[model samples]
Target: MKKIYYIILLNLLTVTFSCSKEDDLEPTDIRYDYFTVSPDANDEESILRRKFYEDHNIHLLFNDTLRHEQRGTYADGTPHWFTELLDLSYDITSTKNETRFTYIRDHQKQKEGIRYAETYILPHLDKELRPYSIFLVETLEEYGWRWNTVAYYNGKRCLALAIQGIAELEEEEIKERCIDIFYNIVDSKTNYYDEELNDFIALGNKLHGETFESAGLSDDPTDEEIYAFGFLTWSTWYQEFPSESSDFTSFLKAVFYQKEEDFKVQYASYPLILQKYDIMKEVVKQKGYIF
Candidate 1:
């Protein structure tokens, strides 16, 4: 009887430990690693050729340095992917009714809207035999996240540039990870005090909430969209508020729980977005944006 009792207790403990492990993992954010490399990336056509080649060869080839340089800057003197063209002539309603320009020279007007493709946008196209840059296309196709530049002969110039080299050097895991990272960024909070641009990160989310009487959520959102919604809303709230609130955990609950009604009403109370953004920025400066 003594031995049986000991065995029974051990079995109970094992089950408890197993349950605890599962519970602990329930809340952990999913992580992923993105690797860069692909066969198509090495193909001759995949190179980002310049208009003029100073090298021995008469023709130019893709230059990675230029690509990085272009990607780093903002269109209208900001450092963000989307460069909104604010129209001062029009009222607030007309502010959003302006043409978007790709800061990168490539996507600029072609022959005054009639000519050969611009040089800047080429390096961003996928040379894959089949349909390429589906992810980018999907992102653009979405209602809230439209490309901010003019559509070139191929497609949105900046998006093409974004996918160019990155496309052919295909790593499914990396692509997925990149998308995941983007979603995480959109869903995470921003801090208004840290920088002005970061504050705008939450614009989409605010508009979303303002548009819908209830929080706007479709039944089935992709992993990327789910992450984006959370990150963007968090960013907007965080940027607006600076102090920490006790409702932090509860706010997260409302967000993930699809409690749009609860979230829209309660997110104002939680100030963790900016606080967390600050900590994240300090801990990983170049990595993820904090607050």
Candidate 2:
């Protein structure tokens, strides 16, 4: 149901079933607001910290930042990450303080591995990809996790960030809308694109329609907006995809990690993934983000 020109990119990247051909719809230079987001984000951690202090710091007795120099950029510079090691001091309980530092120490190594593994691959991932970023585990776990959340940590970092390197209404406005890039959690609903909102918005859908073409509204929907049609799409997934869903996390593991060849079996929703890519690719192009 999402529309046209972007289909060219999806068609080339994915498969015939995954992407349909309706290659006539060209992009408009109208400067639509939703696709206009371009974050010149340099201070990732500081940006997140500020958001926490503003409205999310009520529970922690004490929390602070720690820095360590590493070997990678925030996907900008080719090799160095975490440019400096800042000496941070905090006065929380010993257990809490130790836990926090342990997390930092762990990420110093893990983030480096992630960089090494995906640095080359990301640049080739549809020019609009965001660098891989994960909210510091301490910050996310303490403030945002919903116990055993699946893609919450892995998928967004690998799949979503690659889909959202720079996005935030503003730096101080970083309400960890980081995940919102994956699915626009902030503005998700059951409505269609409200031209009045100056932003592309969506409301819920039953997804009872025969196909993605039928279930979806515009053929040009961003992946986030399509996902805004979550509850229904998720329900239908289990009926067709072999991936059985017990919870959100389980559903994610099944859908994201499933084999592509396997998606065509009995009830697979293969074309949907292709449609998701079309919207994401098109939006990024409109926003002028680099690959």
Candidate 3:
């Protein structure tokens, strides 16, 4: 039966995980000579993978190849750190998926918490290596885990352990980003509300200017800061686009809060902004920013 197989697989995973945990060893080789073809480094997938490699020195292989260059792969043929995270293969109940898939669906919660904590805990973790830096917290939130306060209450020990792993990394800027994400999650109204949601919206609009100012890169920022800005603007473009997440990324990129970065440089041959603005307006409404 599927249930029986699920149970058996979980038990095997437990034993394997225990052994892997005890080992606590880094990969023997950390270089990748193979090249998978990929588009320009500007591609989101390419950029994300490159940043991951630069920070952790861990190689990531893409599902497909682009040009002649290798997309990404480890020098040695071994499992990637991320792959290990997804490999737990724990089961979710058929009933749960029919409804909202809350982060803590079952015992798998304890398992993931333990794994993340043990691998990322300190002195291996850095003080600045909070969740936001690596993009995990936001990535999870976009899917609606509401992990902000829940993670702390449900898995404090594991949370501490994960932060520890961050402390050990060399990516200081990434670490800061992670910390910011942590605050943002905790600050989200759906997770935990310190005040009316609109207050946060007002705060976002008030500091909108910082979005352009922080863009240390040589360009002017619009109301939409980064893609996150777009996401945030989408969250509250007409209501509560905040100064931190959306506006901050725009400031970093030196663009208006409403600016769309997707096809800014290639507008000569085809029209992109007009279509993007239309999409943004729709997203803003759906997110309750316009209503």
Candidate 4:
């Protein structure tokens, strides 16, 4: 009787294993489509984008709408998901933490943006310092404030440029915007050497308790006053001190845009300023940038 019971248990185990093996061999009806279609070979815009990708290692998205995903938790701790269509707008409200929806519909402006980048922006920037992708859009407003010509986003370094009125802008205005955007990109992307940054911060600290307002300096400082106070620009002086990373970026912008000789002469009276300038200059140079 015991042997018969054991035989029955073995048969049951064999049947279970056979059923599991059969289930494993069954095919499922699920599919995943993750690959992006390549641009048309004969398209002029596509050719230009491909060239940028090949030459500068940048993905120039002139005619594409990017999908931005944002995830967070609701007030009651439930998960919330958001999908935003990235485009340009002039009157985006700050009430919601998202921009108003739009699309890149101006082909002329898009082409102009690409040409402007090729002519003035891309040539000046080092390949390593360039953002992975540049999105040309109609207008770019962050949180309903800071109407910027260019803004950098995320570790992948996606850059967005507002090119709504590219054709309408004067030549000088276009050049200024290009340079401004270039410096802004460099300021945000370049990683400074720690020792150099700390030294620069130390120099800034030495000027503690002294501000342009207290020193009787002009709110809009002349070149001479800017050097004397060891601040490279009125904006940097306005910061009062460089206590954070963003403040350091301000210093970098001031230095990058100023002529080297003028910077040296202006900050001559302040040893700390000169020291900070030298440190900043060296660090930037090491990153294959000239300012």
Candidate 5:
């Protein structure tokens, strides 16, 4: 029944997605304010009715109230255009969730590729206004879906959209942090990746800074570059800890309702993924996000 509902939902999402394939419809010009919340938006359904009044004089749009968001067209561009990728529904199953879900279950390879490809072929991942600037790519590996390559948790720090190896994470502190980052992106308002996150890469470690510099990038790194850098760097950082997904998020203090932003942003600076890398490593070893 869930699968049936999923199919029906996909069809509906795609129904209106058959818009012009022309390059003329610039993303910045697309009408994202397609819906409006009434004055009576205090109900459970209006939980994510969105504070459209929060519009900024910036290039990116951010919606902090949503429980879930998506980066690609797995849902045929539904809940799109803003940095939050806003979807208020409590249990929306998206491409990211299914991708990570593979780790929860053994590979059902027969279906993953085709489903993933079909999802990827859709007109999601709008580049000009691509969420967090993370783009999509195909995997050279024999298995894994194409759109599954990258994912981002709304409030968690694992902004995995361009990140590889990490499964689709629909969980964590990345959510609130994501909102804060969006606020930053809009408030700061220059080209986001170029100036705002330039220092986010690690410098000396083999995981990120030096590795990114080794990529021969010029001027600044693209969103994909930052995602790759975070994935490689953090993967190595958490490598020594117990190898469970829960444990990994704990070590990084990436769970919900936690004050991990200080820890996250401090490391988010260019020199290393964690400024107090030693501290987090020890904290995880001692108890592991249990406080």
Candidate 6:
């Protein structure tokens, strides 16, 4: 009877220990499922996106439904969810504080933009130079005043190009848009031939007294000052002297787009411009680009 009592007690203790151990055990991992939609694999737009991804390792996110998470409740008891796309632009002049949202809704324009990129833009850029993701949207505007084609949000590139009359755009217009896209990518990534770029800036400083303002140029400089400073385009010139990076991009555009003979003829008197152009041509040639 004593042995039986001891055995039973030991068994009870063991069972209690096991139960306690099980109860104390906690989950090491926790996961929450997000309800979001992705582009259909078989759809036309998705097919183009997949092809672009496979070819260039670039994600063209046109139709992927961004997950909307509940943030907080509004004064009217409505749930204020976190928006996937945030308005990066700000209006200092306005008294109102509001957030705006924009998205890509047109399937046709999305397809057209992707096709344009694959055909006109991707060929010029090396695989490493391409952005990880490109978001196609209808319009990216700030305070209903200024509109933009390209805007960077959360490290991703946003293209607001699907306007009302997209289908009516001429071939040349489309190609120009593609070139703008190409320019943006190249400008952001590549450091222009450093020595040549420095030389160009030095030339500008020599003529413009170290800075645009120091040379007596106003906030909005005239065309004469812009040309004299060796800026090939007005867009590249800013209030102060343009950054070295921007000067490189401008030089690149001049060499890449315009014919050498035409550029030489146009800037015949400007020896500095001619020298910079030569440097850009050599740099582009080294990168395996013909034009």
In terms of TM-score, the best-performing candidate is 4
Predicted candidate 6 versus true structure: per-residue lDDT over 1-291, tens digit per residue: 999999999999999988888755677876532211244547776676677677777666663344567988999999998755422332344443232335556676777766666666567766555555655555543343554334332233333333334457787886665665555555544574455355555666554324556767776887666777676654434456555666776788886577789989988877768877886677655454434
Candidate lDDT (C-alpha), each: 0.31, 0.32, 0.35, 0.59, 0.33, 0.59
Over 257-291, each residue of candidate 1 has an lDDT whose tens digit, in order, gives: 33345544444443433343333334233323221
Runs with alpha carbons beyond 4 Å of true place in candidate 3 = 1-168, 188-291
The TM-score between candidate 1 and the true structure equals: 0.18
Estimated TM-score for each candidate: 0.18, 0.25, 0.19, 0.57, 0.19, 0.54
Per-candidate count of clashing residue pairs (backbone under 3 Å): 19, 19, 46, 1, 15, 0
Off by over 4 Å in 1: 1-4, 9-37, 49-291
Give the local distance difference test score of model 3: 0.35
- Tell me, what's the RMSD of every candidate? 23.2, 24.6, 23.4, 9.2, 22.9, 10.0
Residue range 162-237, candidate 4, lDDT tens digits: 6666678898787777666666666655644466576766655455444566667656556666556555434454
Which residue pairs in candidate 4 collide?
227-266
How far is 3's C-alpha from truth in model 3 (Å)?
68
Q: Weakest 10 consecutive residues, lDDT, candidate 6?
A: 151-160
Which tens-of-lDDT digit does each residue in 1-291 have in candidate 2? 455767876776778655575576777775422211124534543343344334322111111222334655556667664522212212243321111122333424434423422443333333334322223332222122333222222222222122122222354343233333433211121122323312211212234332445554454444454444433143344332111122223222233334334643422443444333334334433433323
Better-scoring candidate (lDDT), 1 or 3: 3
lDDT by residue (tens digit), candidate 5, 1-291: 999999999987776575544356456666544234445658532332232122211111122232334545645656554344333212334332332322211223322322332233212222222233111212211114453333333211111122233235343433433433332222222221233232322232233223333546443555445443333222334322122232223324432223566656644653333533443434333331222
Q: Which of the two, 4 or 5, has more lDDT? A: 4
Q: How far is 217's C-alpha from truth in model 5 (Å)?
A: 26
